[model samples]
Target: MSDREPEVVRRLSSYDVTRLDTAITVIQTRDPALARILKAERDVLRDHRNQLDAFATRMKFGSAAPWHPEGVMDWLIAQGWAPPKGLLMAEGEQEGQVDR
Candidate 1:
């Protein structure tokens, strides 16, 4: 993680589903296992917080967003995927720091 702002923003925003395939392509190149996890968890990411918290922190969910439980959820929804239910977020959740 550059721990750099603009690079972080770029990485975080790359998760937008509009560019998801491309992003995952990049992900696959870097970490095939995490890419597999991402493929498996595409629509149901929020529930696996512990493993996600661990794996994600290892994988660096962008190397951008912090992978705390809520932060992981934050990244999920920010990617343009709908939240499962009841966890709907307010706008501007992406204003904070993140990396990939």
Candidate 2:
């Protein structure tokens, strides 16, 4: 992954299903393995969304937004990719934080 957002991921996140299908088709041509991995990732996200739906019901709130279970860098790391550490820090740069 680059410093910039992954365009395929962006398109997959789009509200339009046609765009998502097109993005998936294009991504498969470039990196078939990654496309498969992302499909699995999407499944995981969908499962989390289901859980969040239940959570929201029990808590009496609106449906919660879908979220990744781990950080972006964590996913990259698992993929054997190393993203720049400085970019991984949260806002305000809390003191004494070394490796998270």
Candidate 3:
């Protein structure tokens, strides 16, 4: 095997995401299959936003954490994985509201 084979990716910077998004957008406009697949994914995520957020909260805080629609990324951020945008907290906010 080649030593330069791609390693596992841990994260993508905003620039990397922008590049992929540009390509995906272009392809999605030209290809119906990819567009449909992306649409389905979006629809499913939108439909189950509450459930995913709940599941992720459970993963981080066990069953005690009340299920609020805090968004999936919000729950993920509490568990140490955050998106490029990070949490939308006010200045000096030390912890998530749900963490209480």
Q: Per-prediction TM-score, please? A: 0.24, 0.35, 0.27
Best by TM-score: 2
Tens-digit lDDT track for model 1 on 29-94?
Answer: 889988877666553433333444554564464455455566666666665558776465455555
Highest lDDT: which candidate? Answer: 3
Give the Cα error of residue 97 in candidate 1, in Å: 60
TM-score of decoy 3? 0.27
Q: Model 3, residue 30: displacement in angstroms?
A: 1.6
Clashes of 3: 0
Per-residue lDDT value at 36 in model 1: 79
Candidate 3 wrong stretches, greater than 4 Å:
1-9, 36-100
Reference-based lDDT, residue 100, model 3: 46
Any idea what lDDT model 1 has?
0.55
lDDT of each: 0.55, 0.56, 0.57
Report the C-alpha lDDT of model 3 over 2-100, residue by residue, as the tens digit.
757447522233454355456567778689788667666555544455455556556666545455335544666775665565546666776545544
What is candidate 3's CA lDDT for residue 78? Answer: 70
What are the per-residue Cα lDDT tens digits for candidate 2 across 29-81? 89998788767766665655555454445444422433332343354476466
